[model samples]
Target: MKTAMLNKYFNTPHESGLGKTLYQFNGLLVLTFFILTFLVWGGTGYSAGIMLLLSPLALFVKDRPLQITKEHYLIILAFSLMFVAHASAIYRGNSAAEITDLDQPMRFILIIPIFLYLKKVGFNQTWFWLGIYLAGLICGWQSIAYTAGEYGTRVSGPFNPIIWGDIGLVFCLVIGVKIHHLIKNKPQTLIPKYIELSTAAISLIAASIGVILSGSRGAWLTVILLALLFLTIAFVTLPKRISLAFTSVMIICSVLAYAYIPTVNVRINQVINELSSFELTSSNRSSTGLRLQMWYTSIIAFQESPIIGLGKSGLTELEKRLVNEDKINNWVVTESSQQHSDLFDMLAKSGALGVLILIFFYYSTMKAGSALIPPYSSTIVMTTLAYIGFGLTNTIFIGMNGTMFFLVFTVFTIVAGEREVTSK
Candidate 1:
């Protein structure tokens, strides 16, 4: 019965209103995202993503009364909580700069309507993943250039490798889905298995190399952790032969990377050295040290006003505290002022309420795509987890790049999973 309703909602064509325009506009939004994601950089792409929200806005407000429904309520509620947090901060007289943080989660404002529209008309993962794949390929090309030039650290063309790593991780997941389909002989491709497999393999290899080349230890750790979890799941539930093959392939890849990739070796060694040299008291003065200092001060800020924390003012307060503690060197304050970690950024900036909304936002989004099936599910879930992991060591929600990537996928994922209860 439920499937029948879903079928009808999805299959029925728009005969009146701007439904057709709005529906087609959805595809255009994705196409724009793809084009911009691959070819563009800086604030422009993220800005365009935010601007793309206007298409749906016009649909809801311009042509007809906005259709509010139970189907959209989850997304609505999730987004509303984010707004409430931002609004609450502003109502109480927070810095206007604090509002910029809203761009992070606020990027998903159209999930509800977009999901409904997509459910009605359906979307093709083929096109979606293709966009993602092409974007990753661009990153791969730049990575080769970066390495060939002997550029130290990681390989990111224009953006931070952390952000680049985020892109690569999603592409690799897309490759996983594509490869699975190829293996299933899904008849989606006319190309021979060897050719298809080779392309997919190159893409995967390139994406993984790009991630490692970015030298984002955080991303590297997250990918490794995810791999272990996936392997365990495969071994426990998947066919024995398949599991064995996967395990063997993963082991080979890891071994080869660790042995052959100089950057990989350097990063691992750096992690070891950093951990070994870490000191809490008075700070150690390194990349890891900076994070520790920032984290400690953020905790202090959170403790000071657990209910309604310091907001951007916390940065000032943090500086004062660090100054008083004699930890306020030029560098320490420089990094701390930026709120390097998303955990503290949320805690210190919006306090506990911000954190709650954040939790709700991610939870709802992961489940938002609950209506999407199979490979689509994999993409959404992995992307969410990757962002969460990246957020741990970096201010993922603070940066435009990180937030923009998150926004694109969260909306995509929810729409893919959309299960709107339509007319009977």
Candidate 2:
């Protein structure tokens, strides 16, 4: 009876009650962390996220900390390849300017405290799901607010629509899981079920609209892939009727978004045009053509130093080579140095070995996140899939938002969900 009472209301980090209060209140700390992570706008989220680590650090100091294991070291080593790839390039005289960019990814190490804290006390799924709901809600509103404006095709908040759309895609997966869970569990409470079911519906509709309005082709592609993945997983484990219904809903959602949303059609037209009339010469540099044109340089740079590639700062050499060959547009060369695609960027900066490390890291992340309950494992896999799809066309690691999203969630899964069930 005493133990039950204690477990209900108290979280004792140490034997004495002196530090129990702090540990008891750690849930609030975790709530704050999740809030910061989900609200990836401006620099505020990242800043607050880093500061929130103090709570866990304090608890870890007061309570018994986790012992470092070989698995943990290996995971860290996999992550190390990310930073080391850049350093190796710099070592090989890639670019001295990469220092500023290097610092951005280093902040991803904050995932350590985040993982440790959540691992000790488990994550607040209620709050986390709520954040996902709110994100979808906000992005949906933003889409409506931006529609009919000049930027209607790329409806967004502070960040680009691509980021907004990609995150919304992940939220859609969350929404899908929530809806599935509600139905799968056969909730008995009519009132609660209706309320939750309504919330889930609204979240899905809004996130779907947000994705369409954002006009992010990468996100659009991933949405289709994730939807198919969800359906396939369901088909294997769920009733045939349920799987068929899910498949129908996904198809309907895509069709409605494409047909009713003006931005979706616009993006499709742009893609069609870009592909149909792609020209690699300096005379024309379409969006698709520009990406291809830039890729020309990346391919050349990779071939030259296929081992590690051109190093971190190898862009200088690449641009110079582009000028000599005249294979790339002067406009693209002058406008941005980014290869745009993460695949090519990895090849250009780190070479084939870096790409292999990245592939292994992603595979390991999914491996660690496998076999957890609904929304946990599925969420990890689907979100990872979204990023992978997005990375094919964009530079995910070069930016702060993508880097944080990937590391924080990946670490959380490995330490908490994948390694063990939530510690009671």
Candidate 3:
């Protein structure tokens, strides 16, 4: 009788009262972190809340044995390489400031403790998905509110429009996946299921609308590529009729958006115009033209230093030199900071070794995801794909917001997926 009372008082048989309180607090922090990620300026800073709670546990919690897996190691490797590659560049005199540029990569390393802490505490699926739902909901409304005009103007958050668009697109896909999982697993009569489904549907539509409003051409390409890949996966994993119907709906929506949305129409026409007019010799530097020129410049830099490539500042120095030599346009030197593409930027700045590290990181992550069960594995893989798609056009790791979004969620998904496996 005394034991039973004590257990009740403590909240759980396995944890002390304080432990239970901290665990619940961590759950709240998790949910809040996700919601604030897209809603406010410097919202990504909320990750510090989680890090504060987890970091102490990571350092002092010595009673329990941590079941660290190979997947965990791979995840760590992926993060660690971010630091190693950049540090090497600084050491090789590619960039100045030994510790300044290293801060972003160091953020990845700092996330390792949070990863272990979450693995120790286990995951709350409801908190995660519900947070995602609210994030997309608020992000959609905020993006719409930021809109000044309609046709040519873009909707941006506190960050770049491209970053906002890509993040919104990923949220839309994630919510779609959540809805699909609910449909497949939950009973139809459950009121909570319907509520979740309805909110997620609204989130999906609003986020998609926000992505369109951002006028990010890279995000549009990501949509096309991912849509095709996901439709193929749906055909393989879902009923044939369901896959066909979904594809049909997507196609109809795309056609309707192109025909009816003036922004989409104008953006598409702009890309076409830029492509036709762009020339390596001509000074026709539209947005697309600039990207093309920067890519060409990156290639030239890579050719000059194929082995180790130029260090962090090497690309900038080379661009100046090219301008002086009249080998490339002076516009490129003035307009661009780094190569817009992630791979090319690394190749130009860090060389083949850097590119190899990046590829290995992606490969390890995808392989780790592939080892997991259905829906959880699918979520990680989809998130990774979203990053890859966005990185094709933008330097995702260069910005704090983009880096935080990828690292925080990637670690969360991996740990959550592992919890699901262990729970079974």
Model 2 CA deviation exceeding 4 Å by range:
1-40, 51-74, 121-123, 147-151, 186-191, 227-255, 283-285, 412-424
lDDT values for all models: 0.64, 0.66, 0.74
Model 1 weakest lDDT span, ten residues long = 59-68
TM-score for predicted model 1 compared with the true structure = 0.78
Best by TM-score: 3
Candidate 1, residue 268: lDDT = 79
Query: What would the per-residue lDDT of candidate 3 be over residues 1-424, giving only the tens digit for each residue?
Result: 6675444333321244444455456667768877887777657658654664566654444433467778779878888987787666655664356556667667777887787776665445556676888888877788778864445457856777788888888788788877888889864232467777898899898888778888877888888889898798999999999999998999898899899987688889898999988776566667787788788888887898987778766777888887787666778878655678888878887788889888887777787787665566877778788888887888887777777787777776776566332211
Estimate TM-scores for all models: 0.78, 0.82, 0.88
Q: Native-vs-model 2 lDDT? A: 0.66
Supply candidate 1's per-residue lDDT for 134: 60
Put the candidates in TM-score order, highest first.
3, 2, 1
